[model samples]
Target: MVLQGMAAFRIICVVLLAALAGASTAQRPTYRAPQHTRAPLPVGATPEDFVAFANGGMQIERDRAPDDELAEHRRLVSALDGLLPQRKGMVDAYVVSIALDSDPVFGREAREAAKVLARRYDAAGRTIVLAGSDGTGPSDLPRGSPGHLALALARIAELIDKSEDGLVLYTTSHGAPIGIIYNDADQGYGAISPNRLAAVLGALGVDRRLVIVSACYSGSFVPALANADTAILTASAGDRTSFGCQSDNDWTFYGDALINHALRKAQPLAAASAEAVALVGQWEQQGRLKPSLPQVLIGDRATAWLAQLDRRTPAATTASVGRPATALLDQR
Candidate 1:
């Protein structure tokens, strides 16, 4: 009986020791969570993580198609090299480019132009792009649709909502009696009235708003967004269509001209608008379509802006309007 009791006690002690060891192993110290990854978000954390994750995924996908993606990267980087000034993280001025490629409903020219601009922004390591098709488009898109356009507006809100500096908008699309269309899917149904766009952009209270509209009768966008620091560049009057490239079958004549020719000299938005107007007028006269003349709606200090560009950046390249390098922007 004494031996039996002693054996039972020994068994109990062993079992308890094993259980304690198991518990201790299970309770090993856990690693600390990352600052940005805690249960609650940190104060002053811009949605930068979300943007970074999205962009990183996009880059991985792009790498899967190296040949095509690499060419696109080069093109966009070239555009950025020509357009944006290199600086530390925050750009004093913000340029947003939105391309509505998914809707397949309208505004092919505008969509293409958006791709160009987005690529430009991306190469500069900026997330101001509001692109939907991952940077490419289907061969054909319907005219005067607003589906993609609306999406672009929403993304712009996300990017610019908390931004304190000046913001510039560059848009290209098809236009009509009602408003601008992102594609055929949105033509009549999804059209964003100029008033609605104005309201949406105005809600952000941007210090400066510059919009470039490339479409038939794009002139209508001016009155809506016009304000103390706003400027609008329209491809044509309300009744007319703007001519664009046909080889690639793109219809964005205004974007091709503005970027390839007028902007090459690195002029301010005001001077660039003037040269674009004259060039478009000349191109329109030559075409059988009798394209509408481009117009500029300047802010109160428009000339001051033009002068400011002279002080800020080096002079634009002196290449003529019809140069071959300019051909890419006009191509399909």
Candidate 2:
């Protein structure tokens, strides 16, 4: 009897070990190298040439008049036309929402957030959206190229009263420790570094500012963008990544919680951020993922501006019924 029992126990142990090994092997990701390598462009190649090269050499022989440059110029004109007309007396908030990635998910989230803010502030002329098309044409905003973003900010500065008005800038994209990824696939590749962003804001003289960066490692932006007159919020800490960035989803985890859920209720920006953080914590815990630890830094001088904005538009407890439920998937 004892010998039989020992044999059964050994069989069970072997089965368990084999199952663990199979699970480990299944968890390992597969990688593939690119099939074709790009040829280097000539030293004096124009920006158009570079774009053509990057886009698999298709646009090299395209006509110049009806090409990318013309399209970009028309897009810029559309963006400028979308900016809110400056008001006469009371301090108003102008929002410029940008989706820095080419992904459809970022574009959708950015457009939705812009809609919420515009409705909250009654800012028909005060809101501008810069995002790539998601095929739905939510706002028909311009592509969020780096140059376009800079131009938008400069234009906004010109349209608003610098001292009295506030700028709410929201950007959503994939990020690395170095900076936020700026890629309009086939158009170009670049990054928006913390210093560069700070310089843009400073140069515009838009002192009362609210900057929300939704991306992995977005906390890196806090140090440079945070100032006495600016309030900054990030989707994750410098070392972490947030979830739910799939193309099919309506909103990301942070975007769903913060803009879709919390901010839709007309709460203060600080309060909305806190609520979003708590909600994100719950979502991560439920999914058995590590905490994203969304970060916020509201400078002392920015608090008064935020308070005034809040007073002008009181908080409503009503939730937004338009947004879809937050998904649990993660795609970086």
**Per-model TM values vs. the true structure:** 0.55, 0.76
Segments of candidate 2 deviating more than 4 angstroms: 1-68, 135-139, 314-325, 329-332
Which lDDT values do the candidates have, in the order given? 0.45, 0.68
In candidate 1, position 272 carries an lDDT of 75
Candidate 1 accuracy as TM-score = 0.55
lDDT of 1 at 142: 19
Query: What is the per-residue lDDT of model 2 for residues 1-332, given as tens digits with 9 covering 90 to 100?
Result: 01134443343233223222211111112411111122212446444433333222112212234566677688778768777677778667888888876556677788888988776655667888888755343325677766677888898888888777788888887664445655554344455667678777888888888899888768878987887889999999976877766444567788888888888776777888999999999888878889989999999988887777777564555465433435434421
Clash totals for all candidate models:
16, 2
Task: Give the TM-score (vs. native) of candidate 2.
Answer: 0.76
RMSD of each: 24.3, 13.5
Give the lowest summed-lDDT range of ten residues in model 2: 31-40
